[model samples]
Target: MTEPVPPRLLLVECPGLEAPDEDDGGLHLRRFGRVVEALSSVCPWVDAVRPGVCTLPIKGPTRYFGTEEAVLVRVAEAVGEALGPFREGGRDGEGDVGSGDFRLGVAEGVFAAVLAARAGAVVPAGETARFLAPWPVAVLSDPELVEVLVRLGLSTLGGFAQVPAADVLARFGTRGIRAHRLARGLDGELSGYRVSGMGARLVAALGHALALQDLQPGFWGGTSAADERAGEVLTALQRRLGTEAVTVPVLEGGRGPADRCRLVTWSPVVARSSPASSPGSSSAPGRERKGSRRKASQAPLEPPWPGRLPPPAPARVTVGERPVEVLDRSGVPVGVTARGLLTAEPERLSVDGGLWVPVVAWSAPWPVEERWWSTARRRAARLQVLTADGVARLLVTERRRWRVEATYD
Candidate 1:
C-alpha cells in the first residue's frame, strides 16, 4: 500500500450488477444495500456510489485495521458475507447472483479508484498517473473523444494526459478538459455517473413510505401564518446546506409503492400544495405537466393503480429489506410457484432471523407481472399474513425468497 494522495478512496465494484435496467426487479439494488450496510461496520461513512458500487475514504479504516491491504480484505469479506445465500445456483441457476464477484481497489480519488477496482490493483501513492497510463482511451467512456484521440495518434490515457491543458481545452471544450484532468489523476468524480437520490429510491423500492411535512398553526398566535415563514426557513437551509438538504416524499400514480413514491427537493412551491389534493386539482407545482388533461375526448381519468393493496394499507413500510424465512409445517422453506401460488402452506413466520411465530390466516397472493416486454420487466407477488399473536404483515417475494415488506397495526 503506497502512501495515499490528498484523499485516498477505496472502491468496491461487483461486476454484472452495474446495469440499471437489469430485469431482476431491484433484487440487485437490495443486495447492494445489504453490502453497503455491511461495509458500514468497517467505516460509518461508506458511500453507495451507485448500483453494484460503493466507496469509502480509507483513512479511518486503515488506521483501525492497521493497513490498506487489511482494509481491502475486510471490505471484501463483508461484501461476500452480505451476499452469501444468493451466490450459487441462485435466481438464474447460473453460478451468478447479486455481488457474486466483488472487486476492490484503492487510489487517490473515485475515477482512478474505479479503474483500480476493475483491474484489481491498488494505485500506488502519487503514482496514479503512471498506473492509468497504459489503459486505452475507451475507458474514458466518451466515444467521440476516443475517436478524435485515436485519429490524433494519442490512443492511451498517458498520451492524452501529456497534451497541454490549454490545447486540450481549446480543442474539446470543457468536457475534454475534465477528461484530461481525470487522465492526469487530478479529479475524483465525473458528472452523470451518479444517479441523484439513488439511495433513497433504493430504500423506497423496498416499501418505505415517508409522509410530507404538513404546516401547522402557530401555538401562541391565532392562525399564525407560518406557511410563508416555513418556506423562508426551508429556502435558507437549502441555500446554506445545498438543495438536497431538505426533501419531501411525494406519492404519485403507479402500480406499486416503489413506483408511486420518491423524494424530491423541498421548495416553496411544493410546500404550498395540499397533500390531500386529488385528481382534477390544479396540477402539482414544480413538475412539468406532460399529459395534464386530455382534449375533450381524453379526460384526465384518475389512475386506477390496478392491483394496488386495498384500503387498510400497511401502517408502516419497512425502511430496509428484512430477510425472513417462511417455513411450512414440515419445517422446510416455503416457495412460490410459476402460477404465483405457494408451494406449501406457510405454518410459521420469522422476521430477520427472529423467533418463529405460528401463522394463522393469509390472503391470496397478488401476483404482478409488469412491463413484460421491456428489459425492465418485473415479476413478483405480495401476500398479507396474520400470526397467532394477532399481528398482520405484508410479505413480498421475488425469485422464491420471502421478505417482510410492511407491517399493519
Candidate 2:
C-alpha cells in the first residue's frame, strides 16, 4: 500500500432541485455548468467532465492561495457571482442565496472528504476521526451489525471504530467489517476526483406567509391596526423561526383582515416619513378624522380579531437549517429563538357543530351555551383558550359585544 498525495478536495452535490415534479434534467446540467465555470475562474485547473459533478484538486491552489480561509472567501464570492442572484427575500435581508450556498470540506483522505461534502460540512486535515465520530449508524447499511453493536452499547462512530476489526469480522461477517473500516475512514474504493470551480454541497430555503391580522389597520394616521398586529405576529414568528428581525409596514389600513395592506420592510435605507408627502392622502376620507387614535395604546397582548388569540408560552421555531440567533438592541447575536409562547403548535378547539371551550372545569360548553342567541346582550360568553404563548380568556357575543379578559404569548 502507498500513501496518496494530500489533496484539498471540493465536492459539489446538486440534487437537481426544481419545482416539484418538473423533472428538467437539462436545467440541472446547466446549474452544474454555471458552478464549474465559477470555480474554474478561481482555480484555472478546473474541469467539468463528470455528469452533475466537478472535482477540484486544490493542492496547487492551496499553496498559491497561502491560507485556506482566504481561499474559502474568494471561492464563496466567485461562486456567488456565478450563481447570479439567489436571494432570500420577503423576511430575510441578510444576504441572498447564491454561490455561497455551497459547502466545502477538506480532509486527509478522499472518502472522508466526499462524506463531508455530502453532509454539507467540513473537516480540517487529520481530524477525520473526530468529524466522523458523531455521524449516525445509518451511514453504514447493515442493520444486524447495528443491532449487535446496540446490544453491546457500542453506539457512535468512535465506539464502533474502537472494537477489534478481527472480532467484528468473525462475528458479523465481511459486511460488518467493511462498515467498521469505513467508519474509521479506511475505504478502499474512494477515487480522488478533479475540481473544476465552484459547487454547492447543500441548499436550504425559507418560505414566509405574511400576517393577515396586522395589515387591516392603516399605516398612515394609525388606521391599519391589523397591519401592526400582523407585524407583531410576524415578529413573534421570526423569533420562533430563528431568522433575523424583520421590519413591517402597512399595505392598506382600516380595511378588513383580507383587505388590510401589509408588506415586509427590507432594504438598508431608512428614509424619514413626511405626513404631507404620503401618496393619495388628499383623497382619503379618514385622513382628517381626528377624534380617536387607531394605533393601539399599546400592542395588545392579544389581537382583537374574533377567533384569533396569541398562542401559549414555551414555543420552538426553526427558521431553516441554520440555528436562529436573536439579536439584542445592539444587533449582536443574543440567544436561540426557542422559548415559551413562541412554539406554533396547532390545536383544534371545536365541538360537533358549534364553538367549544376546554379547561372550563367541565366537558359541557357552559359559556357558549349560556349566550347562544343573546343578540342584544352587552356581555355574553367568556371562554379561556390555550396556546404556545399562554392562556387567553375571551368574551364573545352574538353582536357588538366583545372583550378579552386575559392572555399569554
* Clashes found in each candidate (C-alpha, N, C closer than 3 A): 0, 49
Q: Give lDDT for model 2.
A: 0.43
* Regions of candidate 2 where Cα sits further than 4 Å from its true position: 1-8, 14-22, 44-54, 86-100, 114-121, 141-144, 188-409
Query: lDDT (0-100) at residue 49 of candidate 1?
Result: 73
Cα lDDT, model 1, residue 277: 32
Local distance difference test values of all predictions, in order: 0.73, 0.43
Worst 10 residues of 1 by lDDT: 209-218
lDDT of 1 by residue, 285-362 (tens): 444222222111232243422345655667778888998888999999888776556788999989899999999998
- Report the number of the highest-TM-score candidate: 1
Please give the TM-score that candidate 2 achieves against the real structure: 0.38
Model 1 TM-score relative to the real fold: 0.49
Q: Which run of 10 residues does model 2 get worst, by summed lDDT?
A: 334-343
**What digit string (tens of lDDT, one per residue) describes model 2 on residues 219-238?**
22222423443554566566
